[model samples]
Target: MSGDGVFSSGVLSCLAALQRLMDGNPTVAQHVGLHRAKITAGIVSVEAGFDRGYLKKSRPAHLPILAKIEAARRSSVSSSISSTSSDVKRLKGKLRLLEDELATVLTQRDKVLTQNIQLWERVRELESAHRNSNAPELTTLT
Candidate 1:
């Protein structure tokens, strides 16, 4: 095979190896260091049994593999962002529910306090009236 043909075959093999890693193939994952590190060009090259030097940016034949790696990285990042956004939304909903419950409890406490104050005032009035009714009558001696 010519140099271009060999590079093309190597590129195709690397792409296949990347796909296997993405698919969670255990053997491929271990071999490519996917289980311990992120999917990088060097890892993919190792998985495809290709030399890492061929993956340099100066090589036109290697550009496609690099592009594929970048695309996979972006895809994982966007998915992670979306999942984090969903978690934030869920937590916000829980916080709103807790705040509402607290408001309800505070309202009930205020109502009970007002009722207690009113009962205390009524008891004081009754005590004053009882004291006045029990007062001894004054006798005037001429």
Candidate 2:
């Protein structure tokens, strides 16, 4: 019974170490942990009725699967971030173009306002000339 307890503790320690190694990938780590639990259960069954050779043969298959799963997740995240970056750059370009168009419109508006002021000044001068021409003249009897 003591030997069995020691063996189980050793297996738990190994599982904890593997879990730590997979900290960067939580989802994959969870899957790996579940797989390890299943493997541990199978080892118990083997100790009860099967051989050690079977355990040795089955051990190497799942590590490669975990690595592949982690790689696919990394690629997916990489593509998403890159696409978002491109979208941000495109939006910034559009904003700059809008700013430039606003400046051009403001310049045109200033020119129109200047021309309107000049026209108003000309109208005022014409009114003043007409008023002077129509003034009554006083003549003295001689």
Off by over 4 Å in 2: 1-70, 135-142
Candidate 2 residue lDDT tens string, 46-118 = 3323332322324453344335435545665677688789999999999999999999999999999999999
Worst 10 residues of 2 by lDDT: 36-45
Model 1 lDDT tens row, 34-114: 542277888778777776654767778778878888888888888888989999999999999999999999999999999
Residue 14, model 1, lDDT: 82
* Cα lDDT computed for each candidate against the true fold: 0.78, 0.52
What is the model-wide C-alpha lDDT for candidate 2? 0.52
